[model samples]
Target: MTTNPYDDIAEWYDDRVRSAWGHPGDESDLLAMLTGLTGDVDGLDICDLGCGQGIVSRRFARMGARVVGVDISSRLLAIAAREESANPLGVEYVNDDAQSLSRLSGGSFDGVVCTWSMADIEDLDSCYRSVERILRPGGWFVFLITHPCFQGPGSRWVGAERVVVDYFAEGFWRSENPDGVRGKVGAHHRTLSTYLNGLVEAGLSLERLVEPCGIAPINASLPDTSKVPVFLAVRSRKT
Candidate 1:
């Protein structure tokens, strides 16, 4: 797949990823964090960047926020639309690259969220800047992504240390699926510092950082899963 498989994988995308994320402990941790982060969304204006299949997007709408979900893939947007209609949580959908949240009105949102999508973006600086532009001063920008400190392209999951090969830099990562070869998946990698600096450059202040050990059955056996963080959730405020 040269291009993003989201367009073609829309049908089965939800099932596959959902199964992986829906692990009992995984879901609980995410839900608990989200519930705590967003206690009462009675009238907040929220935007979900790269809101795949409207998972978190719809959830926010259900919390009584006026939600807008944006994505680059039409296929994912289609599925998100279907989900919006079926659930009818009043979530609005937009098809656009997350790097350009400027398409929306300035200072239009109280909270902006990006989940599991930052890794796929080529320009983290632009994306953070755009998010800052769309959010009101003091508004929150919550981002969830794969932990870059441990996971990177071609980094084998061999028990503990995710031995990364020649990918010690912060940029694009390429991996081969057929084997542990490089340059196959066109994977990208960025150091955690790059992301933090990007947010600071965008005029956002870091509030909290969380590395969630997903609530999957395998978590019980994998020592690395508990010792090392797998996913990161960053909370920031547009200042």
Candidate 2:
């Protein structure tokens, strides 16, 4: 049977994942970066690719953009739907695979936003291709993912030094943290080259790459601003 990490914590994933950082739109860094690349978001048709629970979608919708949120997790979609109903911001939530966002019309979206989901994708090439197909020329695709260098489930803390196994390796990975609640259920690890090459192969041009650090909620409590680079934010455009 295929494992679903979100399913295990479906009931609490929202609070845990959402609160893992401070505030709801802590992911606004990606949005800010994207808007910096494209400028102005009003009336834009935005697709929240792999949008879990519609947090980012809600933010975009509030900005007067037409937001369509797509994800594979039914549980997460349920949460997203609830938010949409309450907010009535015209955000549409669809249960769909990231690699094939066929349910959405082609060349329709002005921007595609994804958060913390790229590493979990098994077929990234297909995902990028689908993004290219769905976005109009010059449309932007922004994404946040785990930093391939320092973060993952296989990381071990031996004394004060941390050890990472297969940090450079790519392909499916499965590792369980001691807490069990946090785990790498299954994922594809790729280098910067892989993602850049995939974008080029999909006829997209890389515009910006960000390695965000010390942005987590816990970081605010820490005196020192060093643990790891926990996130990678990327912006690409269909050409």
Candidate 3:
């Protein structure tokens, strides 16, 4: 059976997302970098691709950007929508696949932000293509993903050293979430080259790349994670 990570663990995911004092608006550094690349967000339309529970979506709206959140999981979207109802942030939540983005208008978005969800997606090429189609010319597509070279389910800690066995293989494996509530969740793994080449094929020009030191909540617990790049953030512009 195919695995659904956030379906049942939506509550857990929501709590963790809210409690993450470390990551304000996913990551302060990421927001700064995205803004630097895309310019001011005020009065701009943005898509939160693969947005789970609309955590970052609301943040962007608070920053004066019109935010539209798209995700495949009904459970996650429900949570996001519920929160939107309570806060009236004007953030719209759509139940849609990131790989297609058919429901979103083409060339309508000023920027796309996919935070910590790139590895969670399987068909990244299609997602990039759809994002490119939805973005206006010169619009930026910014993403944060677990470093394909350093982080994965197969990682092992041997005396302070985090070692990974296979760097070339791309596949899905059960998630190792600390709460253990989402054991059936699968994390899709891909190489750095695959993502880079896929963006190039999608006709997006690579503008900025960031490897934040264990800044995200998921990697903050790992020993010495902050010392090395555990999460990689990339910004590409549609030409």
Candidate 4:
């Protein structure tokens, strides 16, 4: 069986990769951004696409939303299930690809959230289509991804803490993981226009854009992020 990259690193991700997804005040945190976008989500039916280890899904449940966490990796779902069992947050976990949520019916969710996984998804356009199909009209699709303009495998630090990045370079790129979530992980990069266009093509209206930094938590080691954004979070409506 081909091993899923996320599955290989699920155990260490909470402590290692979690911060990369952002937190309450860290800016690019999709959960925090979603809360700000849709106030009072109590009783909302939410689907967490690409929900690795169910961290955000549990958070959504805590916010009084009925949450279902979905991912392509069984290993990650297993870890999420373990966490859910321990806490009993009433979050459902599913093992499935984000691009093909065939088990779910159309117009089923009130909102959807995906964080720190867009760059890694091979068929993001398909995922967007699925998200649009599953979300009711006016439902929100919130997501966060590494800022393609300033953060990627093509980025390098230079003198005076300057950043050299390839804004136009696009494709799969691999880099060594400093957090040991894995020795290496592959992330696909596309232009900012490409990301925005994908949503437009999928019938989602861009509502808000935020470039958040993880400076407070990671600036000591990744100082470049303090100067530039680490991630881009978007809130789109399926209207």
| Candidate RMSDs in order | 3.7, 3.1, 3.0, 3.1
Candidate 4 — which residues are off by over 4 angstroms? 1-3, 17-31, 159-162, 176-183, 213-215, 218-220
Best by TM-score: 3
Separately for all candidates shown, the number of backbone clashes (residues 3 or more apart, or on different chains) is: 5, 0, 0, 0
> What is candidate 1's CA lDDT for residue 183?
34
RMSD of 3: 3.0
Clashing pairs in model 1, backbone N/Cα/C closer than 3 A: 25-215, 26-215, 173-187, 173-188, 175-184
**Leading candidate by lDDT:** 3
Poorest stretch of ten by lDDT in candidate 4: 23-32
lDDT per residue for candidate 3 within 1-239, as digits (tens), equals: 12256787888877777766334345555555545555678898999988898877887898899999998878888889898888898999888888888899999999999887787778888889999999999888988776788766566556668788777778876546565422446678788899899999999999888776655445556677766677678889999
Which parts of model 1 are misplaced by more than 4 Å?
A: 1-4, 22-27, 175-186, 217-223
Extract clashing residue pairs from model 2.
Answer: none
Per-model TM-score on C-alpha atoms: 0.85, 0.85, 0.88, 0.87
* Candidate 2 TM-score, C-alpha based: 0.85
Two-way lDDT contest, 2 vs 3, winner? 3
Model 3 residue 210 CA deviation (Å) reads: 0.6
Model 3: residues with Cα > 4 Å off, grouped in runs: 1-3, 21-39, 175-184, 214-219
- Model 1 residue 239 lDDT score: 85
